[model samples]
Target: MWRAGLPGGLRAVFEGSPLSSGGSPRLLEGKVALVTAGTDGIGLGVAEALGVAGAQVFLSSRRAHNVQRAVETLRGRGLQVSGVTCHVGRAEDREKMVQAALDTFGAIDILVSNAAVNPHFGPILEADESTWDKVFRVNVTAAAMLVRLVVPHMEKRGGGAIVLMSSIAGYQPMRGLGPYGVSKAALLGLVGALSPELRRSRVRVNGVAPGLVRSRFSAALWEDEAVREQALKELGADRLGAPAEVAQAVLFLVSPLASFVAGQTLVVAGGAWSRL
Candidate 1:
């Protein structure tokens, strides 16, 4: 989900997924986490963060190889972790991933919905119907559906946390990535819409909106010298945000560190002008 070149025949993400292995935090010691789009970039960082904090982590990607690599990397770090190939956009795959997490870890305590797609990068109106649908399917709809599946398990555990990934584009609306921005905007709304109700179950729902981060998936945004320079002017010469920086914000939200926080999207945009 964090890779580039979306839509049609790059990587088969939605097929029935096969489960895979190995595996936290010292805050999430007995907790279990399920993270989608977690093979690389921000997703991977979040998985690692939660694991280090003492949670058994569950990671997923559309690609089997990605899942294998991620599982190996985390296990190498001595974290309790497992993985499965999943297309978050696919209901069957989502179900399998959740079951795998439960079957492997006993119960669920944290959920991170990071799957997203940006098939079209142009004026919003110019984007085709399919483009909009694909964007919403993976970016917005899948996350909500995941909430539905995991919240019940969370309630059983007495309480849990859900962290939906958003982006700076969600607020600022990137020039050409209109469809993506809008879909992310919906996540911000999802946070607001779902939080109050989730609180009834002792579950806190929050969001993280990262700015441009250095990752293969986003290399297109700031890899160029001119664009990099412009980005630096806005975010400071230190360079674009890193996936781990964003992960820290997510860790804060999922941990007891933010027990009183819910329904709010934490912006980890460095210095970017992001707000709605």
Candidate 2:
């Protein structure tokens, strides 16, 4: 029931038999995944990919309307997906999201911390303290808190996988996005810090740093023709990366495919100079 030729050209991966020709091997079957800020862009793409891989997905966003629309969109494609409105920066909303996932799926096997914000776009020193607080609170503090909240549930279920959404800028900070880049860079360190603590519980933690992905959330970068061309030139990529392309990397990290991959930040930067 997955739509023919999904946005990422994943038709073969989600249509027909669970093991369709060149399709996913039902890697996440019988598992449940929770994706934050999953109503649109990269989050939605990841949710759709996980659902296609056979996980009952629990998605969350800050807006009720966005949550409703995403649930309806994925459900229309025959995926077992539920959603809730959760502003990740708020402790109460985060609690509600985790409880909702447990109430709906009983157990948690995967967590994709994709929610992030970049309200300021200027020189790092030019950014205000309040902006920095908001950035770190939503992009780093909230993600770490969510991990703490879900680890127990994952431990009870035996073991689990966690993927933090980062950015190529985390490695090579982009111009006019210094604070955003720094916040993403923090996640790279977080994977290392949390992996050791969570390993005892069989929880594997990793991160994904995507480059110049096309999304409404990133329209400022890609919608401007000159900027898009320049960025693509720097990346040596013929075109902008799709949200689904980044989602696929996320899928690999959260599935058995990445069982031995932990405490590392995989940069999907299309040959962009991202070494740090």
Q: Could you tell me every candidate's TM-score relative to the true structure?
A: 0.88, 0.92
Please provide, for model 2 over 92-190, each residue's C-alpha lDDT reduced to its tens digit, 9 standing for 90 to 100.
999999999999999999999999999998788999999999999999999999999999999999999999999988888687898999999999999
The CA lDDT of each predicted structure is: 0.84, 0.88
RMSD of each: 8.5, 2.7
- Model 1 local distance difference test score: 0.84
- Among the numbered candidates, top lDDT falls to 2
* C-alpha lDDT of candidate 2 relative to the true structure: 0.88
Per TM-score, the best of the predicted structures is: 2
| Steric collisions counted per model | 15, 0
